[model samples]
Target: MRPPVEVCVFLLSLLAPGVLYTLNNVPALQEPLPILGIGMVVLGSLLLLLLFIVRHKTTLDPLFYVFAEFSFTCLVGLTNALEQDGFISNFMGFYLKKGEPHLSTAYAVMMSYWEGVVHFVLFLTMIRRMFTRKSYRSLGLLWAGSSIAHQLVHVPGVVIGKYGSSLRPAFWRNVPFFLVPFWAAFLLFSRPRETPIVTADKIASEQKKSLLSRPVDLLLSLLLLGAAAFSAFRGFVVLDCPLDTCFTYIYQYEPYLKDPVGFPRVMMLAYLFYALPLLAVMLCGLNTPGCSWMLDWTLFFAGAMAQAQWCHIGASLHSRTPFTYRVPADKWWPVIGLNVLLAAAPALLALRCHARPAYFMKPVPKGEANHKKKKN
Candidate 1:
């Protein structure tokens, strides 16, 4: 049987860039735009492969994978949009010479809007699945706060930009709140499900008797805790650094300052935070059924990190006029080697987990009975 429409949409997004080259005017392959386009296509293909596996077998919660894909697609679309819109100039050199709008901007924006709709639907599903009425009500309040902040930061840009005014501050302000639904989804999924009373009692007794218990659960708990700590530190402390001293600070100069680092940082950080929890949950034995969720996140982070290195770090290192202070051009291999290793490790781990049966046996939720019927 084929996967759902949502899964197909995500797969198409990943493949769209390469397909676009064949279908529309192919952009130059040597530039970052083509590279990014190809990267998305590859990532989406990997995810679709995993989704196919889950659809054919296993009983894991389908919505989890759907929601995860939604988050990942949003992230990828946002990344592409930011780059196509010339936001990445602060961190990387453009392949095209000055004075041309990126051909891919419209495609990126359309994908981003669809991503937002999917993301909101995913949030609603999570709320229904994990939260009781009272808990969801509390979560709703938090969502409202984040939504307000997000709009305050982003809506003005949309409004003012229509009137020929710059609203950069609005975009910056919205960053922190943009992922509130994502974070809420993470917290909702992290809670332990209610097991049979007998099984619960047995596990409780085992826990009291032995320190070594539920290795996956232990690791998951630690990861979640660590991610939470890291996020808190980043928000309250790391961002405290003055605008002139941040890692991407060099880009704030007159010529390069046309692009701001705030939006990219916010987008990347939110994606990383959202992904970490899902990874933790899967690692903790949440039966993902397929590797699509894993693949989605792997690509999302890999793409973001690549952009950071190429644009953020690389750009800063060469920001000097006339591009001075270089070792041999041949030394570029070392950086490539490091990136390959970093991207490969998680993908290998995901493949290994996918090959095993222990992690793919989660039961489907009762609410998704119709979805199951449709699949059958």
Candidate 2:
């Protein structure tokens, strides 16, 4: 049998966003939002109509949630493209970029394109079911984490820079971007909590565990913790630098630390804020049995680290920064490799969590009486 009506509607919903995007940009229709708003209504009506025709209950399945994510990413990707290309007609780009002198600079352009590319890749990956669940979870985490980091860069740049005076519109327009990933993350982690029944003998037999039972699992957990440390360190380094210094040193390395028209400093602050808390949870939960939530958290951090690293590394390499301050030749491979490892660590950790989830499974006590008491 075909998937439920929700799945069909979700498939249809994907097309509507791109169609609305095109309609909004039509030359004769100088004002696009009214039309866009109407388009949303029409799209909603269509989904409702589909539900009626199918005679099926409205269900919020995993694929449906994935559709929501894909649609939003596509819309944002369109706007990012418009902003970077200096399209005055696009209301969001005009207002947000016009106020900020940096939006026009090369660094802003590079960052915008980078975000657009990342979002686009995610869009394709979700729609295509291009990866295994383990791989998909990794991608989802990377997307969620990166999205949160991207907004961090956006908010501080708009508020602290030229757009500071006109905060209301920019803040509201940016709300959905910030909100969606959080909701998605929650949904992704919401595997139902259930108590498993097992005999005392079985539990005892399983408890005879070896630390090295899964060498790869232990290694990934350590790698994730290491990456978390690096992320925290980077954030602190960014914030500690004097606002106008334009460069900061962490140990012997001096990477670009300027905020530019964009909020590189603020972006780092957001990364640190989001990463450290999540990392803490993951570490405490690392050996935690039945901590399926760790899988979701791992995905989220993977995205955050990947995006934050991109912003940091991209800023340094951009022509806007002095070439001398870019990753030095001697440190090129090491620095780039470290960043790559940081991004990869979470993905690997996520796979480990999924594969060996039983390793972390909470021990179930024997007897219904005890289970009921524990529940009570």
Candidate 3:
């Protein structure tokens, strides 16, 4: 066994800023067309570097390549966040101007921070797990959910929002960002779940308990319902519902939902149609016997909510947002507190399932259960 090839990937990600500085200085490279070409060259260089590392000392899991590439992209995303905040100059300005102008918006700025920071840390952690020969299945599921939710909102939002009219050739560079996560997700879900070992009696006793008996589950059920209701309310607020409550809530509670950038609007609707129903099913998972599915799905849902909430909250308060659209000072606590509650429910539910999963485990066969009892 030799040193892992992925160590190089980590190093390259750290070196990204210097590389961007060098690229930024090239006058010709400042143009969008040249910048796009530079992207291809950089990608090709990374692929060649990967191949070389593979030939030397690599486990060479296909996912290793996917994650390595994605981790590098995280560095780029971080650079975007830095540039958008004016902490860095010349690094991403050219690309920001023509490649993807939507990124200049407050929602996009916050999204860049989430991707650059949260998602970057996640990808790197998963890669480290792979290097250590540990089970990354759960983390992979988390990253997959986060990445897919990001693309589902981001790509479509850019294409259809106010920025749609200024579409440039460099915009297509997001193709991999849009497509690779779905592929990675399919691969991750296909892998066998690495379940924890537990005695049959433990599973039996846990599964035998009703929802009412578990105070935590009962409490979480109520919260999940509240989260679902909030999701629906925000969806209606974004859609410009006729209800006076919706109108007041939009203006006073979350005017960011009406931002021209479109990402916030799409995000609220996603909470409505996709995340809302899942909350109900998740409630069922808490009460139902033998719902092993909850373990994986809840982890996935938790990741999405975490990312979604981080971006939504940050963007809503970010200075880039028009002051009029920003969260009002008078109603800040109620609005932020409600959003925080909804965001926390999935995480609590996931932690509950994963921390002590016996209740959600499949029941052992009667014969097997008897044998285990006798053996014990």
Candidate 4:
């Protein structure tokens, strides 16, 4: 199979069931389908695990994969619980059917919040790894501090619930999700200016001579920038109706979404605002002799896109429809078209820029020569 086709199959195996649950109405498929869907997701995740093991011989960022897997599991578990309880009878119908209280709801909510926390930790780690030692240390402290504050809120919530208190802690326990971007903004704003590592003279005279040179590098950087911007914008803005009161109700009804509008908006703005500085660092590192900064950035970008899609699906559940927003048959064609383009663009761009091949190369100098010597 073609690489693109393989990737599509992999993604569809993970995403199709959730999408179907959200956009269809088939009773027999309601409960069993999510189980089957989650099975596929687990299969895909295992495949990722195998790939990581065989290739990296260590691990993909554990933080990224763990949070992603937990998110999928929670989603599937929630759907199954809701369906069995008859809260969701058919795809389009919702009615409260009381039964023995299930701890799955609380578990699912806690997992969801932790997923956000893990995401913040992952990004902060990525930024730290990409920058200087001093910057890394400073950001590490900030991440640790924010994490403590976030969990402090959760402690009261957990304790109060256990003590038979009717009052629940505020939903702002999830605010760390947005606070991450705010901290990133502070880092960006306070960062000192620096001169470009590659001089115009070098680019004009030497670096532009070959296909694998400065121009190609610049193009790849721009593509990465564009992909990141598109993903962030879609995540923060496009998926929701701007004027819908549902936005307010999401925070009011779902304790998780409280203070939704302002935080997300601020986070999104911070992401956009920091893009240039981050891109500059990426480009500088890419231009260095032995650095694989481009590949690192691409991985971060792809992970962010996946996280955004997950968030989009999760937030959609907060709507009045609550998982029965159907896409018309006619609309499917366009939606599929858009999804295809969105998924394809990043893969193609990565391939064209040789980013993936470079990623598979060992990070140490003379890595290939050393391997051959050991083999001999």
Name the best candidate (by TM-score): 3
lDDT by residue (tens digit), candidate 1, 1-376: 6555444445544543343334234335434445445545654665676576456544555434444444444554454445555564321123222111221323224334433454445445443443222233223323333333233323332442232243322133224345544564365445443222222233333334321354643444454455444434333323444544343322322112122323223423442455345445545432233233442333333333333323322332332212322222444565345434433433344444334323332333444534545665
Report the number of the highest-lDDT candidate.
3
lDDT by candidate, in order shown:
0.38, 0.57, 0.84, 0.39
lDDT of 2 by residue, 86-112 (tens): 563443333233223345444455556
Question: What is the RMSD, in Å, between candidate 2 and the native fold over all Cα?
Answer: 6.9
TM-score of each: 0.30, 0.64, 0.94, 0.35
Per-residue alpha-carbon lDDT of candidate 3 for residues 174-259, written as tens digits (9 for 90 to 100): 89878988898888888898776677878988888888899999999999999999999888888889999999888878888888
Model 4 residue 279 distance off true place after TM-score fit, in angstroms: 4.1
**What does candidate 4's lDDT look like per residue over 1-376, in tens digits?**
2233223323433552365365344444334334345345555765575355335324333333323343343344344445544565342221111111222233323334434455334443543354222334333333333333323333333333332232222222234443544454354434552212332333334433443654665666566566465545434442353645545323333223222222223233333454334544654554553343344343443334334333332333433222333233344454345444444444444354342234223333355445644776
Instruction: List candidate 1 segments past 4 Å from native.
Output: 1-238, 242-263, 271-273, 279-346, 359-376
Candidate ranking (TM-score, best to worst): 3, 2, 4, 1
Judging by lDDT, tell me the better candidate of 3 and 4. Answer: 3
TM-score of 2: 0.64
lDDT of 2: 0.57
Off by over 4 Å in 3: 1-4, 57-59, 366-376
